[model samples]
Target: MKKMSKLEAVLWNIAFPGFSQLLMGHYIKGVLFVVLEFVMNVNSRFNQAIMYSFLGEIEKAEMVINYQWLMFYPCVYLFSMWDGYRSAMPADEKYSFLPFVFCAYFVTVGLMVSPKVTIFQVHPGPVFLPMLFLIPGLLIGFFIKFLLAAKLYTK
Candidate 1:
């Protein structure tokens, strides 16, 4: 089987968790991710929250959201992307996992602060707020990875 590009794998995973794994022929892992995504989405009422959040019904979105289940989303989603990217790359060109690590951390922090944060006098709501925070997370991850790579190469 022909190998996929890292970007392609990441994009496929973004469309739906496990898709990249499926393309990579990791059937069991892919199925598990898909099933978990479905279960978590249903239990968390994520779609409803997204709808309410988009409609600017912050309170309604919060009310319908299941925080417990919702918390699992960032980790799973980011991990899938990381795993996909890692799988697609050549072994010797392996990248650090710092990006995924920081993304999960920052996303969780975003979730925690989402209720209290307001950007530009507007509440970002749950869905969008975490996404916004992801930018900073990615930046931090890249910086750390750079530092680590520099240190390693200097040795």
Candidate 2:
């Protein structure tokens, strides 16, 4: 099989599972991707349960649920997409983990405390209703990002 450049390999792998390794001429990475996908799914579910258990405490509940989705999920998805896209470009770009770390703390802490500053609210339900929407929404976002990346990167 023909060899693919770094960028091509990353993109193809993102779009089509194992496509990247195929391009890089590494069949093993492609196969391992199947296992990686399963691990990620299981991990996410476990995290969801743990986060949900925090619901007993309103503050903690909002903190985990909102922070996970509104902040954590989007940032990760965007970063991955950007990384994958850059990798697919003619010249491969190095992955910088700093921005991701900065964003993680900034968004998580920001969202966690932002609600306290709110002036008013109509519904007094202990649990924030929006959490219902945000939780599932972010999960969907991840799935979408993965699929999009897969599409973009695959040859």
Per-candidate alpha-carbon RMSD to the true structure: 1.2, 11.5
RMSD of 1: 1.2
What is the TM-score of candidate 1?
Answer: 0.95
Best by TM-score: 1
Per-model TM-score versus the true fold: 0.95, 0.30
- lDDT, candidate 2, 12-118, per-residue tens: 64464455554545567545554554454354442443455454444544444434434434344334434444444555323233333344444445445555633
Mark the 10 consecutive residues where model 1 has the least summed lDDT. 88-97
Clashing pairs in 1: none
Q: What lDDT is reached at residue 75 by model 2? A: 45
User: Local error of candidate 2 at 39, Å?
Assistant: 2.1
Q: Write one digit per residue (lDDT tens) for candidate 1, span 63-126.
A: 9999889999999988989988898888765346898889888998898889899888988878
lDDT of 1: 0.89
- The regions of model 2 sitting more than 4 angstroms off are 46-155
